[model samples]
Target: MNWNDLERLFSPARLGRYSAARAGDTTKAALDYTYNLQLSEAMMPMLNVLEIALRNGIHTRLSALYGREDWWETWVADTNFNWQNKEVAYAKAKLNRRHEPQTPDKIIAELTFGFWSSLFNTQFQHVLWKDLRLVFTRCPKHQRKRHNISSALNQIRDLRNRVFHHEPLLWLTPTLIQQHSVGVMVINWLEPDLAVWLNTQDRLPTKWAEWNITSD
Candidate 1:
């Protein structure tokens, strides 16, 4: 089922009840709730980034290359999957160093992964790898393993979708906030120089040098 379907299946009050039953103590429950909120927030930047990129026409290349017909259109006009935020338009306009004009596809890919570059190293790296795995591997929907990016993205999307659909967040998981190493690799592939930029951001670990991704 789509993310919206999942949201209606579980409600927040029902989630609270579930948590009340499963949590061992007040501290544990509080931590769980906080983690869920943090994860939801963390997932926003990427969605914002994607929407910005798409709106700006930055993702034209990948979308064209992949033969995307209506995925993007479906997204923008989607009532159930509203990924837009005002910052996205600003982000797109501000993409080029001097606001140089860019094609839609390039804009999307650059910003899609560029947002990855802006994330806290831990979450960014993991989500990047998760996307890579999803894109690279050939997995059927029936046997999808622990796909990391979707887990996090889906987690965030599902939460938002639930709220939009007038349902509560019942199935949120707390311990799923950590990165999956995909972000690091995707940054390296999409923007070779991102390694150095990440260094400047102070989000990546020192050992990140071992990856040998070029900034130029």
Candidate 2:
């Protein structure tokens, strides 16, 4: 929420410079490196959490549309989560065994890209288009496009990469926050549908408004 937090995140080097300038001690350089490393490490699980939420959210939307309770459980069940199994395939496919056993840098890269894009070269654009068509029958190209959802997904993917690659991330900018907001927008777009679905199950979130789109 704080702009300084973002600055400390996406561009920690800038903050390091300021700190080094303020502190004439030679140890300030080491302090800056330590700070940068800590921030990058922290970003890993934070971005992972966002990615997990994204996958869960997407599946929730799809399940609501199709009423496939079994499929929903299968997608998330701990036993079936294999990122590398041969049976696993596609955007919603299970994670590889290697990912589960030991998350490698390469696995992180694959996850960062695979979650947003189709695994089998399927035209995902049509999926977004379908959602848009359902919501807005006819509108300007700008309005017709799933801007919020697309933007949010892209931001999540991008942040995932930055985190996986050990890039500095402490201070976030307004633009970065806006990117996270895209996920919020996607959730908002599907809220009514989700509400109807949840009502049937009597599991409505009591304080949905408290949910801000964050990696955490």
Candidate 3:
């Protein structure tokens, strides 16, 4: 699409009139670069932490509860939990296609973030939450409600999809910051030492200041 068309598509009202008014500047290339850089830098660290923490957290809990790291295989074998059947099937297919032995670590790594997040879904909440909550030790301490973990995960998943899909994020700075905090908090909840190291590695604050995005 042409510059004008691209601007119209991406420069939504959420980005403010300043962005929309400057849509033609530099033929939209500069703006696109800025948006991509800002969003990518802001989301990268959290994405890394979220994926690792989610996988490890779930693996630990399930392994303990089910008495094996390969609990996912047995969990999927049960026909009763039909709600998760499709996700489990997809995970199995991913593992099979890899031609690698289906270890719990491999399967957990292969499973999509959506699959892990879905553990909090109301359908499986009753069956899964009892065991799952034990892994998220800090969630109850901070949120005081078990459901908040799912809510945060859902929000992070949405933001992740948008960022990865090259969608506009300029308009979502506030939400992005909020969700980024959620990511850090959840990471800390999962592993304190890792979170401490992640704080040192985080680039969001520096990038935010570089972009001069007002916290208002």
Candidate 4:
């Protein structure tokens, strides 16, 4: 339909960025919103793979470091990174509330992306990073500083939040390309072959090249 139709369907406030950007061209705004929606949909596969890969990679490394599969059983008591204790406790508590077993894998799944990404923050560098950093198997030897990975993950997490919350990505398309690139880069660092496989499923990059929405 037209701007009025789009406004009614998506709510005018939601579509306002598109309308305002295109000189009140509601048609283009609707189209932009639709494009963002499609790109957001296309982004999921890569993100899903990345999230799983990251969590598994970390779990594996931590388990090995502690010499046990359920290292988190004593993680807070034994590890110096006490900062993450509450996050881990929260994850376990949520699982208990749902009547789910607090298994290691279950707890890992329950932990937020924020928790995983936070491990890379410099505050944890002194404690967690010493051992956890080894999880990035394919990360370049010289370029594997905590800060670099932390920055990339923080940006990717921002995009993840935006996408999950149904925020407009059209306005952030240019920077989003970099953010997604860093996401895949993180995946590559953890699993090179998996990262290569991910390219086959990722579609947003190709669509971005075709639409070049940043210009309009």
What lDDT does the true structure give each of the candidates?
Answer: 0.39, 0.43, 0.72, 0.81
Instruction: Please provide TM-scores, in order, for all candidate models, with all chains considered together.
Output: 0.32, 0.41, 0.80, 0.89
Question: Per-residue lDDT for 116-205 in model 1, tens only?
Answer: 222223433443334433432333445343443344444444444543443323243441222313333333433445434554544223
Please report the candidate that would top lDDT against the real structure.
Answer: 4
* Runs with alpha carbons beyond 4 Å of true place in candidate 3: 1-29, 77-80, 140-142, 213-216
lDDT string for model 4 (1-216, tens) is 877877788787888888898888766666677778887998897789988988888888888877887776666675555657888899989998999998888989998888889878877787678787788868998988899888878888888999999887766854667778888899999889998898889997987665574444
- Which one wins on TM-score? 4
Better of 2 and 4 by lDDT: 4
Candidate 1 Cα misplacement greater than 4 A, ranges: 1-14, 17-24, 46-180, 195-216
Candidate 2 backbone clash number: 17
Worst 10 residues of 2 by lDDT: 203-212
Clashes of 4: 0
The C-alpha RMSD in Å for every predicted model, in order, reads 14.8, 11.9, 4.2, 2.3
